[model samples]
Target: MRRPLSLFLSAVALMMTATALAAPHPVPLSELFPNSGHARSAIIINKVLERYHYRKVKLDNAFARQVLAKYLAALDPNRAFFLARDVERFENGARRLEENLRRGELDAAFDIFRVYRMRVDERVAGALKLLDGQFDFGRAESYAFPPSSASSPSTARWAQDSAELDELWRKRVKNDFLTLRLAGKADPEIRERLQKRYEGLARRIHQFNGDDVFQTFMNAYTETLEPHTSYMSPSTSENFDISMKLSLEGIGAVLRGDNEYTVVQSTVPGGPARESGQIHAGDQIVGVAQGLDGALEDVVGWRLEDVVDKIRGPKGSVVRLQLLSKSSGSTAQTREVSLVRNEIKLEDQAAKTFVVDPLANAPGLKIGVIEIPAFYRDFAAEGAGNQDFRSTTRDVRKLVEQLVAQGVDGILIDLRANGGGSLAEATSLAGLFIDTGPVVQVKDNFGKVEVETDTDPGVAYNGPLAVLVDRDSASASEIFAAAIQDYGRGLIIGEPTFGKGTVQTLIDLNRYVPGEHNDLGRLRLTMAEFFRISGGSTQLRGVEPDIRFPGADYLTNHGERSLDNALPWTQIKPADYKRVGQVSVDRLAQQSAERIAQDVGFRMLTERSKLMRDAEAQTQVSLRETERREEDKRRERAFKELQNRFLQARGITPVDEDADQIDEDALDAQRKAIARIEVDEAARILADRILMERERQPRAVMKD
Candidate 1:
């Protein structure tokens, strides 16, 4: 059975050739948008970071290794592109990265990126080839989506001539086709759509210029320091300015990349997407199209900026989006929505007040709710000395006065989904409730602590006040809430706030080096941290609510602590502040918790949240059509049952089992109704507090 020596040698030679072919070919790096001031820019950035960054870490050899790993991870996070050998090659320059950075030499970074580009090209080509073969729907196969528990292949595993990688890609394409097929797409349509999606990926890679690579590399560097600190390229700086102005003509949704899908982060209150009520946070946008008659373009693997460009258009124009419902059991369920673009008016973000009737048992008390979307201020107008400039503090103060005039018994400041804005506004707003005291503490990079105090001695309206905050309330929101809570001015209700307390100062790179015509991007450097009056740093542990609600799935991944590089929580000396309110949060929390335990809607929400968490934890998805369909049915049943329970609790008409074709308006109404239920619960909690306060007062004092 001995084989000939020449035959064995021939087989070994063929295997070696296959391995070499599988290894990615390095693409030559070119200097595009050559900046003569790169070395100067790097030196200035390093100097500023070392001098002013809050962390105050040295950029030594150890730090260089971390940066090297971070850069590689940034480029190939999923381990689907660059091979292990490429990573090893890049590691050879790791120790020298710090020295190179000090000298403004980015050759190693550029070399790594060039290899990444080549790997992307190779992978895309391989993926496209997989689409040519027929997939077996009956086969028991699965695709492990990202954040998978499985580790990446080693260099030796990758160098092997086995068909494992090809099989993995084949399964991926098959999964894509299966999802579309379940969504009612025919075979031909599915193939064509997937082909376009893959082609778009290659096209986007091919279109990457030097500025894009530099931006990516710089972001990797800054983000390694902290999550919030970032470097914005010149073009991105302009976009940031536009966003701050809130005048961009688009659907008004903040989109972020999650794996291969573009997910809706949040919708502007007055934007087309929010008004239409068709889009929601956590929904995945798979395809986009132009006006009414445009063909649907698959945007699964498109760049985030490219997708954003397609979504934005002139005011009054229509743009269509095809979305995969996050709530749906299967990704196959989709809906198409068309929205008319419009400007996000300042009025939409302004503070507004409304009256809510007392709880079912307590009928006489009327509660006022003031919704503050963001801690906004017209800085330009204010700087120009416009006495009537709009700001969150001024607007909220007026709303409070208006509510008091309306004879409301209590007031609730709703800060749900209020991502914090101006810190000045937050302090001024807190002053409206408190007479005069320290609002927040700021600790700079050099260990210098400064107390931000409210100089105003007049309280606007301090009657039975309550501040409601959810996980989205952050930074300035936390500042205001903490001040109010520390002074015992209001009850903090709802979920814990988002834990982002660091202060970022923008450094214009061009200013550091004069006579440099190149457009050097700005650096958003975290130079300070915020602390509550109670001395606790709101870095990772946000302000905990007095009364907690059912857990939300979004909280699993959307908190400051979820970020790997987020700053840690610490404490300092507590600021001096006197308690002004007599309300007992502990008793109120107990009452609310009891009520929630008995509430069927809350119970249903809790169960649904658990199901969502379980679903998200699942990494592998079946490719078999029958199994997928069964799973889909199970998920639909669970969702509908939860919906029915919520409706039953509210005494609203439950949706019929066979009534699957609900109109868009009906769906919007349902969503609003669900939201109203939560608001109603919050109002009831305030009502309970009002009644308790009434019971505590002396009869003579009450009559006065």
Candidate 2:
């Protein structure tokens, strides 16, 4: 029964190879399990998917398998990494492991692990080819890396040979696959090539900057840290900054990593980065120098963070970057360009507004609804005293003033899916409506409370206000809603807000290290929690809307309190701020109750939502055919109900199939009408009920 020497050598060789490869060591149970981490990466990903209103898996292991499989399939769809036979090979491997697991044969798991590693090797080879062809790091490409430490030495140097580079990528790819598999996508190889193809198409369409790599790395680091502690490389960190910043200066080109070089990913229109026009995504950055006299430093093989810092400078100051254009066929040329950075303006994030007289009959009310997607702030501009820096509070203030000047009778602050932003901005925004009041409260790690108050006495516009929130509204949105409700200044309407009251501080962990290792230092820590001024914390339990409204699934991921490590909700003594004249919430509540009872459209939506929720809650999936049939029926009922509601609300006959199938423009119009009708119905119900109740009450109700 002795094995052949070659077979034994092959097994031994595989083990040696695995050891030599850069593999993540198994984390100690103490550092990785239970309280050490969220034990909820699957939950977080599912929550994000839910915001898109995805009726899929609950926060469970089964869902995790599917997500991992989907991500893998998208990563490599052509079966390029796996043998067509390997589909069955992986299944067989899984079956063996399952059988062994059932029999309590722990040692037999090695057989499956060996098979998985071989398949991973195959996948990595394919990925290496893809990276070779796709990655083109250059001057235009800006990427950053965390400084190397004794534990994680500078793995930043380029490979001696392209083949070696490919091998490194192969290791990274396999690591990525394993991490994702742990996250819950089950079908490891089936439809993988197709998913990869879809992913490639999406990247092309979006002009993605190989951000997938960074995300993968972050996920890997996070997976090691109990699924919460994450490593953000410099370039990735900058991208995060760009997303959060209300404004950014410099050339508007987006650069990404390709092999060892930083390549331009895309162009931002009208930006100093874009205006240089010589740079673009795919163009490699070779050198960067400050001002006219600064010496040029070669950037090839440098981490993107170092390159980005060289490119970023004080506003109006010049930074010269040398770029190797990838788009140029044959002889790729290097060009140097100087750019002076400036600010990104307000019109960027505000909703595209129009005067909607859709119901021609509902005139003068002129509902001024501004869809605020984010509470952004331009820190640089604010620091520079550029009062023009675009911000949520400032932009909204201007918007309200304009609406009031235009004689708008009612205003809707549409933050239906807003994820939230700057706490300062959110509190300041609340000041725009009420004369002065306490907006929100904060409790640090030590439980010391700090109350944020609005000292301003001048109200911007005091007309009828309705804030449209959903499950996606979190952090700042919750604060504003809590304040408005406390003061009785406006009605907070929509689905329950996302509960995310925790405050995180980005403390550079690299500071703890010595010398160069401290450069571009360490991690962001969740240091505190936020609370509503009324004493309740908007932590796990978000604010309940005054009037509920239906929302798409994507809105589910908005609040952070749903996240693990989110500080628990607590309370403090209420602030002594004066409330605006109290608007009777009882009448509004009664009106909403009646409207909900009478609205068939609303009923159908709730029914459909319940069905979807039930389906999503299922641990075991149904047969494809059965699932399809059920989904079709659900859609048919929803469509019919929507059509019936439209007809009833507009006083028009139901449209025939022919009219319904007209055009995209018509469909969009119908959707918008549905939203408007909901708003109108809610508004009318409030006005009528409140007026009637006032008339019914005894005279001399304290109004001057």
RMSD of each: 10.4, 18.0
**Each prediction's TM-score versus the true structure:** 0.89, 0.53
What lDDT does model 2 reach? Answer: 0.50
Best by lDDT: 1
lDDT of 1 by residue, 1-704 (tens): 10111111221221111111132232235644435455566667787788888997588888887777667666665566766567778888666888888877777877787777777778788877877878899988788765521111121233222255566677778888899988889998998898889877777776766667777777777767776677767766765555444444567776766557777766665677777767876688999998998999999977676677677767777789999766563444677888887766667789988988756746988889999988888887889999999989889988988988989988989988777778889999999989999999999899989999999988998688888888778778889988888888888888888788888777898887788787777888888889988899888888987777876433575557656578899988988877787557787778777888787777666776666566656678999999998888788777778778787666676644235576655566667676665566788888888888888778864553
Candidate 2 lDDT for residue 470 = 67
| Top candidate when judged by TM-score against the true structure | 1
Q: Which residue pairs show collisions in model 1?
A: none
